[model samples]
Target: MSVVILTIKISHFINHVNKMLGKVNEEDLKSVIDNTKRLTGNLARISDNLDEKEIANLIKSAVAKS
Candidate 1:
């Protein structure tokens, strides 16, 4: 339930951001979506092998880069 709610909230936030940005290039948006999907899938498959600290660091790194 929490995962579903969080996904919905994140989707809404992405939509809001997209609207605010206005006139986004379709190819760039598609590339970002594709990369995000690939990253999430890879993370899900390897999550059991990662510790909480490693996961937190990965999130921090990604956030910093973005």
Candidate 2:
């Protein structure tokens, strides 16, 4: 995702949390939970171009050489 879009999501999350401050209601709680889930899901979807085993092999080879 673009940095701009991430920034906007963070801004919206901050605003949503801020607005819920000093209030305790069922709807507010649910909204917070939903927003948290969405943000986490988006974060989990960020592109990962690394291979875990490849990294471990590279480290092992370097350690053996050194």
Candidate 3:
């Protein structure tokens, strides 16, 4: 019963986000997509340069902050 309620709440939240994004203009949306791609590229480069131990520490730090 609780799991079903949680799923309903999450679905409503996603629907709300979709509605908001639907209102954004085309140029702004394009900029957001470009920035996301750049960030992904940067993450790939950073991971490629880091050792296993360094990557594990970075993950641990991210989890702690969140």
Candidate 4:
């Protein structure tokens, strides 16, 4: 997904967490949000580098063998 969508989802998650657990530490929450953004960005980059056609072919080969 796009970064915009990821940000909106993250914001909603933080809001939900805040509501469920009152008085969360701002520093801790900030750390979590930052880490999440970093991790998702890395994952998106990795996924972008992958060859979708190659992966699909591999999957099809495996299924055909089975």
Candidate 5:
């Protein structure tokens, strides 16, 4: 029950985001997802040996570069 509600809410949220962002092209969306996957991989690797401050700094740097 909770999962279904969460899925519907998430679907609505994504539609809202698309409307606000002016409709991203399919290729652009795919590229964004690819980049996010790479970022998540980096975060996972960093988490293994990095401290909290270091992880925060990494995220800030990634946001700036992105």
Candidate 6:
């Protein structure tokens, strides 16, 4: 996927999470979002391309880090 698409996906996830639960901690949510974006950027640079597995791994690693 392109950076634009990846960014959209991340935004969607954040919105979805926010909608599903009330009273989320702003700092924690932002941390997750930032880590996700960082991981996506790293994986994109690593492969210079996007694939399902790469995207999945990037998300997994970011979540794990958090």
How high is each candidate's TM-score? 0.54, 0.37, 0.55, 0.44, 0.61, 0.43
Residue 11, model 5: lDDT of 100
Q: Write the per-residue lDDT of candidate 2 for residues 17-65, one digit (tens) a residue.
A: 8886747687888898998898666545542544677656755886799
Expressed as tens digits, the lDDT of each residue in 1-66 for candidate 6 is 999999999999999987866676778879989988996678768776777888789779868998
What residue pairs are clashing in model 4? Answer: none
Looking at model 1, the pairs that clash are: none
**Which residue ranges in model 3 land beyond 4 Å of their true spot?**
51-66
Which ranges in model 1 have alpha carbons more than 4 Å from their true place?
1-22, 62-66
How would you encode candidate 4's per-residue C-alpha lDDT over 1-66 as one tens digit per residue? Answer: 999999999999999988966777778888999988996786567567678776567558867998
lDDT by residue for model 5 over 12-52, one digit each (tens)? 99999989667778889889999899979988988999999
> RMSD in angstroms, all models?
7.5, 15.5, 5.3, 10.8, 4.5, 10.5
Clashing pairs in 5: none
Each candidate: what lDDT? 0.89, 0.75, 0.90, 0.80, 0.90, 0.84
Whole-model lDDT, candidate 4? Answer: 0.80
Better of 1 and 5 by TM-score: 5
| lDDT winner between candidates 1 and 6 | 1
In candidate 1, what are the lDDT values of residues 15-37, reduced to their tens digit?
Answer: 99989668788888889899999
Could you give me the TM-score of model 6 versus the true structure? 0.43
**The CA-based lDDT of model 2 is what?**
0.75
Candidate 3: tens digits of C-alpha lDDT, residues 1-66: 699999999999999999999999989999999988996887688898998889779879977998
Give candidate 1's TM-score: 0.54
